[model samples]
Target: MIAIDNKLISDSVLEAQFVCDLNKCKGGCCEDGDAGAPLEIEELNELISNYEVIKPYLTPEGIKAIEKQGKYIYDTEFGWVTPTVNSGICAYGIRDEKGIIKCGIEQAYYDGKLKWKKPISCHLFPIRIQKSQQDEDLEYVNYEPRQDLCKAACKLGKQLKVPVYIFLKEAIIRKYGEEFYEALAASAEVVKK
Candidate 1:
């Protein structure tokens, strides 16, 4: 496991609060495509500029897939035109013969091409930025699960309680910028509706 250190922009949170339900998630985000609230062009550009190595891995095919779908990010309501090649599995993910799904980007990151990493939301599971507010602030929200997802069997849309703010903050700032990262942190704070 990789250890990343950073202070959360809000709250007096600490490392003790975060929990990654890796076993339970089963790569749900990649398999279940959704048009996340799109990022601004500047933010997207920052990711590309600061992390150019992964740019190649981000195949034009993926962009075309998004374009064909009429959006940059996949969404549930619109559905994918090209069904996930691996039986609805995300393009960069694959389940090994042992039936364990491994994340390609994460693998690449460990392989030394750190540029092949994902945005914070992609890297930080179970937590997503659902909406952006007008004050340049954003609202983060959890996705509605088909069933209970946590080991605690917590209901969907309930706060993830994973204490991932610091991890996410580092990821967002590294890929995007402190500004975009700050907005995302604020967004992540929205109470679940």
Candidate 2:
């Protein structure tokens, strides 16, 4: 583990290669999970604040689900999460013509409609950040690739020689600060020796 402040980042995040091959996976992570994408408290507020801006990018079903379930829902195990469409795909997920699911919030951001992209949890997918139960100040940054869904991404990452941390650079920088990311990179360099 690479310890920086209160967070312990997994070695797998440094050693393993992983990049999302969206074409191959078709955004399976967005649709196949037991629950919708986890949302931070700020993200829940963003959804509520910008639902109107994001609505046009969503599918009919997704919009309907959001309308019925509110902007987000509380999950016992996961805390706040985006509401799912009929308990299947996420309400914020928009399926393109090619059937690849995409985050409507992200799409809206791409179109310059909103400043907030998507849930940070969704942004840092495969790398989950959970607060340690034993210590309030501690959080674990774990690289948890789902074999059933992430085969193509894993294989492609190996082929491309991209380390998981590098693959998730933007996300890591988003969650942690740039200095923390530099710390992680420095740790990776030391570990490589």
Candidate 3:
């Protein structure tokens, strides 16, 4: 494990490889999960505040689910999370003509309607940031690639020689700080060698 500040990063973060190939995966991570996308408390508040702008991007079914279930709901296993449509896909998600589910929040962000870019958990995908059970203040930054859905991503990463940590550089920086990502990069140099 590589310790950086309050986070204990998994070795796989430096060793494993991944790069999302949305064409093959078709955004399965957004829809296939049992629960909705996990959200931070601040993110829940942000989503609520931005819902008016983001609502236009979501499907009618998604909006209905949000209206019925609230912007976000408390999950027993996952804590705070976005409400899902029919207990399946996230309510804030929109399906494109390609049949791929995309984040309405992200679409709003891209269209300059909102500042927030979806949930932190969604952005830091495959690299799950779970709070340490022993110390809630501490966090585990682990690389947890879905074996079934991430085959193309893993194959692509290996072909490109990109490590998981490097592949998720922007996300890691967004969740952690520039300094923390720099530390991970420094460690990757030693670990990969």
Question: Which candidate gets the maximum TM-score versus the true structure?
Answer: 2
Q: What clash count goes with each model?
A: 7, 0, 0
RMSD of each: 8.9, 0.7, 0.9
- For residue 23, what is the lDDT in candidate 2? 95
Whole-model lDDT, candidate 3? 0.89
lDDT by residue for model 3 over 1-193, one digit each (tens)? 9898898999999999889998889888988886999999899779878889999998999999999999999999999999999988889888789988789999999999888888989998988989988998899988887889989999999999899888888888888889998999999899868
Q: RMSD to the native, candidate 1?
A: 8.9
For 1-193, candidate 1 gives per-residue lDDT tens digits of: 1112222233322222444444566545566654342343444553445434543444454444433443234345532222243235544455655554665446667778775454455554444434434534444334332244433323211255545545345655665578766655455455221
Candidate 1 regions off by >4 Å?
A: 1-18, 33-83, 136-147, 152-162, 166-193
Candidates 2 and 3, the one with greater TM-score: 2
Off by over 4 Å in 2: none
Provide the lowest-lDDT 10-residue window in model 1.
1-10
TM-score of each: 0.47, 0.98, 0.97
- Model 1 error, position 115 (Å): 1.9
Q: Return the clash pairs for model 2, or none.
A: none
Descending-TM-score candidate ranking: 2, 3, 1
